[model samples]
Target: MARDRLHEMRGRVAIVGAAESDEVGRLPGKSALMLHAEAAHNALADAGLGAKDVDAVLSTGRQTANDVPEYLGIRPRYLDNTQMGGCSFIAHLQHALCIVEAGVAEVVLITHGESGASRVGMGGGDRFAPDTPPGQFEMPFGIGGPPTRYALAQARHMHEYGTTREQVAEVAVSTRKWAQRNPRALMRDPITVDDVLSSRAIAWPIHLLDCCVVTDGGGALVVTSADRAKDLRRKPVWVLGTGEATCHSIISQMPRFHVWDAAVMAGERAWAMSGAKPSDVDLAMLYDAFTIVPILALEALGFCKPGEGGAFVANGRTAPGGALPMNTNGGGLSYTHTGMYGMFLLVEAVRQLRGECGERQVAGAKTAVCHGTGGILSASATAILSTER
Candidate 1:
């Protein structure tokens, strides 16, 4: 698409409501679908609306798109079940923009619910069949799960960029400081770089502290035209820009180990569409599936030069009261990671823009950049949100 056309779509749609399920982290009682319903109801109630007002619905996970509306009692005109992994919710926001603008849907609700920890109501399937790419190409070689896959990227980054273990540990240490101030954070205890470095190693250079917390939770958002958002219950967080990109699906097939090319592409498009630079952002909600993930994101998203992400995040640069406040909901590292965490990123960004985050709020924050990664560095989505038009 032309640059002018992309720019024209900025702020055409807005998020009027954003919310999480009644409770997050270790909810053994609530099934996956129940979490979805709870979050949908909470989001709609937050928007001062109801199921009857919704004309569209989007969701991911084991449940089908139709299952979401069926459970919520919302017979929608449109439904989307685009599952790209953790970043799916951010991509859904981008799609909702087009749906509302094209008159295909007036009110769209994008939801995410996962029983990642409890495994309640989750279906079982052969993730890697013998004929599948992972099973055929990667799994036979003893490539297990995310920890091992992400460790390869981290090891290469360290080898190439001279990124030190301490620098990577700083990401966890600094993010923990932010989590300490968040009441909703699951692991809010203060942690130092030394603590992170000393934690049990999950994979080489990736400690237990570096990985995101495994929790059960759900979140939802209500998207509509900016005009309609004006009369909503909460202040509208405008969708200034949106972008999505995908690289290789399997970890071994990533374009480059040192840099996230997908994030670079997605961020550039978002920056162009929003007409905003890194300096204009008041806060950033970068997906932190692992400590190294946000370090790579900083460089790819233009917050810093390539190979300088490690140094940039060192010494409390992204912590509370720092120059750049990131992952204010304590991130997936300390907050909650219910399989796909992208929805929580949007929920926190919307709340921060609305000044609803009492303790960890970035004072006078107007613009936020929410970026999410799906799969094993396979997909990326960037969304620029602001309180302004």
Candidate 2:
């Protein structure tokens, strides 16, 4: 019955508009809320719609749900502030579909913005308070922030599968190759596997080059029923399927150190609903908060078998001219990563399908798989987007 419901939901909603802020890197001047409003306005204009046309609003960041709609001067009939960390926006796509299908709302707007580098308007607070689960358990063990926590998994991946550091470095090298084609990317210079290996080491097996860049940016998406999307300004990028799952909140509690079971569950559900396999994916936008994240995602999402992701990405397979283009926008590794990066993944996927990516465009890309990992592999969301309904 659940399978039938998922099949029925396929292609019922489409993303009509997508946009990022006017500027995406090192914006200490723009407050987090300001970035949100700018991206929201641009997306509405992209859809040839006004703020008044939106009946639903969804956003996640340092701000509250009421704060976003209020600042946008919108009184949405529906509102969602589901905060699942970086993957919140991708999960929002799933919520929007359900809302539209149930006739609860139409023309849903999902937005995200953050001041990761400048820390302009982000209120003062320790992410992991003394009383919090992470503060009590993980942080006390000197496992704070992404690098230290993720190192545990990266080292385990190497121990379990003979995955070499050179193979991991290839991910950074290949992603930078794509960044070289993107004028908007923060890091466009060519890099070799040796460069990544020689870069500063943040944690065991995780080099500085393997980590995502810190920037200030925002991105937004507009979704509506498939019927209404045909009348919008841009070509409707159909939302064929979406799935989200969670495994653990703290890194210590992760079920398996090397594998991302949450991503596996999400990807399986997404593939089942879309009726598309990894073989059918023309492009992929897997989150790259760290190189290992995408490598693990490749295996978890069925792009490659477990323990084979390092090999899958080693030979420029995900580079600009590769057979399967991944992270054409340079990804969080080289592109803008404003704390939460899943929204940008969706924006790039939509633009690639619309043939608006210019030099970085993947020619004849009809199907895209966007997968996001949030909070130390604690949460995962997968979206299957296509040019066809």
lDDT (10s digit) by residue, model 1, range 1-389: 53446678899999988999999999999899999989998999999999988998989997677898998888999999998889999999999998898899989999988999999998877667779999899889887768889999999999999999899988888888888988888999989888988999888889899899999999999999977887887888999999999988999899999999999988988999999989999999999999999999999999999899999997799999899999998999999999999999999999999998998989999999999999998999999999997
* Candidate 2 lDDT over residue span 24-48, tens digit each: 9999899998999999999999999
RMSD, model 2, all Cα superposed? Answer: 1.0
Model 2: how far is 212 from its true place, Å? 0.5
In candidate 1, clashing pairs total 0
Collision count for each candidate, in order? 0, 0
lDDT measured at residue 253 in model 2 versus the true structure, 0 to 100: 94
Model 2 local distance difference test score: 0.92
lDDT scores in order:
0.92, 0.92
Q: What is the C-alpha local distance difference test score of candidate 1?
A: 0.92
Each prediction's TM-score versus the true structure: 0.98, 0.98
Clashing pairs in 2: none
